[model samples]
Target: MTYHRTRIRRRRAAALLAVLGAVAALIGHRSPPPIPSPTTLARQLTVAAGDHFHREPGSGALGTAGGALPDDASVFDDNYPGITRLDPDLLSALRRAATDAGAIRFVVNSGWRSPAYEDELRRQAVAKYGSEQEAARWVATGTTSAHVSGDAVDVGPTAADSWLAQHGAAYGLCQIYANEPWHYELRDGAATQGCPQMYADPTHDPRMQK
Candidate 1:
């Protein structure tokens, strides 16, 4: 009887070892997490206040007539016109979107604005809207303006804005204000997680409260 009991115990131990080995093999063969899509990877690119700004090479003259912009021209991307300086990351994302969409041209209605220019825009807004509080809804103050920070761009015409509205998030660009289809900013994780809910306007943006 003792011999019989030892044989049974050995058989049980061998079965247990086999089960453990099977489990280890199963784990080793498990698939890796899915790779992010190309659009998703593009969206992960960084946009920071300190990011460098770039202009098209040899852009020399500044006015609407259009040529290579002079180094002193207030804006970059003169090739398309009306664009001021743009954050490097933002520009890259915009170009990528344009390429993906097969857009012939992407016009920048507004980009990096100096504090003074923002202030002037604010003044115009106040004049048109009748109150600073009301103007704040559409135009941010110089200090709070995303344009001043080089993190925002106002793209146009209607077709471009429409394309961006639908596809910008894939490139990490999001329309920040519900009212401004032309405006977009870089939002973290927008590629994978998607963009945050938009405020109605600058006035409604919590960042503008400061």
Candidate 2:
């Protein structure tokens, strides 16, 4: 009788081992989440930048009337002739971050600007602030402005800026100036290790010294 009981116990232990092994094998074969490749990101960027506006579901085509945007335009504001004026990579990054935050739109306060426009902005800053040095802290010259190169964007609606500040680095986008939470630029490897320390302001950036 004791021998029969031992045999039954061994069979039960063997069955348990088999079940555990199968479970482990199943887990090992499970696929990981897909990471976006650079090529894929580039393609997404192109598509996003090419579109002029994002309309709500059921909304009809939009047209500018009396120099005013439709009430439901995707972006809060834009100075460019078209959204494509912004850097594709930057737009791609912003889109990814916005999606993660459940934001409906990026709300661009500014995007690519012509050299003449940048220069004019600088001049206005100097006039209002009372010195070229003070203006330099707030606005870059035409030659040095990232906006003129289509590499930077100024996002608005304080909530969007706050979201970017906390999460932009995960998409290779980073706030460049400590004083300007709305400003962001693409920085290589920002997605993994994260962005570098921000300058206190543009004046503190070495790139602005020139």
- How would you encode candidate 2's per-residue C-alpha lDDT over 96-210 as one tens digit per residue? 7777778446666556656655675667667756788877767788788887677887675668877787888888989898766777899999989899998987889887777
Sequence-dependent TM-score of model 2? 0.62
Q: What digit string (tens of lDDT, one per residue) describes model 1 on residues 1-210?
A: 999999999999999999999999998897989986422321221111111112333322322222112222322354533243567788788878877877345666567666655675667667755788876777787799888787997665668878888888999999998867778998879999999999877878878988
lDDT of model 2 at residue 5?
98
| Off by more than 4 A, model 1 | 1-84
Clashes in candidate 1: how many?
7
Candidate 1 residue-wise lDDT at 7: 100
The per-residue C-alpha lDDT of model 2 at residue 178 equals 76
Please give the range of 10 consecutive residues that has the lowest summed lDDT in model 1: 44-53
Q: After superposition, how far is residue 85 of candidate 2 from its true place, in Å?
A: 1.7
| lDDT score of residue 57 within candidate 1 | 38
